[model samples]
Target: MDYSGSFAQEWQNEEKEDNNQKGRNRMIHFRMKNNIGSVTVADRILEMAALALAVFLVVLAVALYHYLPERIPVHFNSVGEADGWGGKGMIFMLSALGVVAMAICSAAAYNYKMVNLPFSLNPACLSQQVTIIGRMMRVLSVLCGLLFIALMLMTTVPQWGMQSVFFSFFLIVMTSMTVVLIVYTVWIYKKGRQYR
Candidate 1:
């Protein structure tokens, strides 16, 4: 009967449906964006905590290096004069290197948080890549601390020298881990370029 009016009514109905679909899409997009923002903030906090731990380890290393010798009396004349210097120096070197590696890792972590925190929350962000790197640094730090304790023990327990072979093996492992961490850091930086 009234074909023209009927066609106009049909067009209006289609337009309304399209508008509703667009509105739904916008809401979903906004929600996803908000969630990404939250993830990024959480990642930043984790990175900051890691950074603080790194700083503490560095300070501890320094204090141990300086204070240990003076605080403890060298009763070497009684026990064949324990050579604590070698162990202390080795530990000091390890601690210094650990500080450098941790600093690099912290900078990389901060860059990652700053660059990707606002846009998307990628699973790669929480991947073992960063965790492994951190663990590598931690292993090295622990080794240094252990060496410090060994140095103290050497003063009282001369027989601890029997375990030098084990410590040497761990030193090798530490070196290998350090190499892996350096390589991993480079790879992460390269991969993260796309995210940024």
Candidate 2:
């Protein structure tokens, strides 16, 4: 006689789980919808640029094959001196690794919108943050690719001294990445405040 009451209670429980006070259902739907939908033009362009940078590294590595000596410097010292050497073939591996890194970053950028962010906000703000993250990932990927390419060339060419090269490269790349992180932090702070 009370089976109907039990069924209604079960349904209500399920609804409550799906729809919390914060509109969990809406938040989830927004996340899923905007994940692929909110990709900005700049994000797409940067991702493509990352792919191109990888390809360029590969092509450049191949071209350098003829110029690189049988043994090339593989590692450098803090003072910009070569402390390690390897076969010329290893040059390709450097660029190949860079390409792989770039690919991973590009994938991350493409899927950044799907990542679980800590802050809960309106769909528009969420989309904006996602796009920013995607663009940043793409930019960082390109920077990584460029760094590898530069390293490869520096190691292969005899005229360019390794002195201070890595120091400069790391300083520049680290600075750029730090700036991105700072910007993202500020963005999250401001957007989070709006929701609070």
Best-matching candidate per TM-score: 2
Give Cα distance to truth, residue 164, candidate 2, Å: 5.3
> What TM-score does structure 1 among the candidates reach?
0.31
| TM-scores for every candidate against the unseen true structure | 0.31, 0.70
- Model 1: how far is 2 from its true place, Å? 47
Which residue pairs collide in model 1, if any? none
Over the stretch 93-119, how does candidate 1's per-residue lDDT look in tens digits?
555555565556444442334333222
Off by over 4 Å in 2: 1-34, 113-124, 159-170
Candidate 2: tens digits of C-alpha lDDT, residues 1-196: 7799999999999988766855976888776775743666776777777888888998999999888888888887765567899999998899889888887777777676433456554655656666666766778788887778768776765655553665577567757777876776567557656754
lDDT of 2 at 127: 61
Off by over 4 Å in 1: 1-41, 66-87, 110-196
Pairs in clash, predicted candidate 2: none
Candidate 1 local distance difference test against the native: 0.49
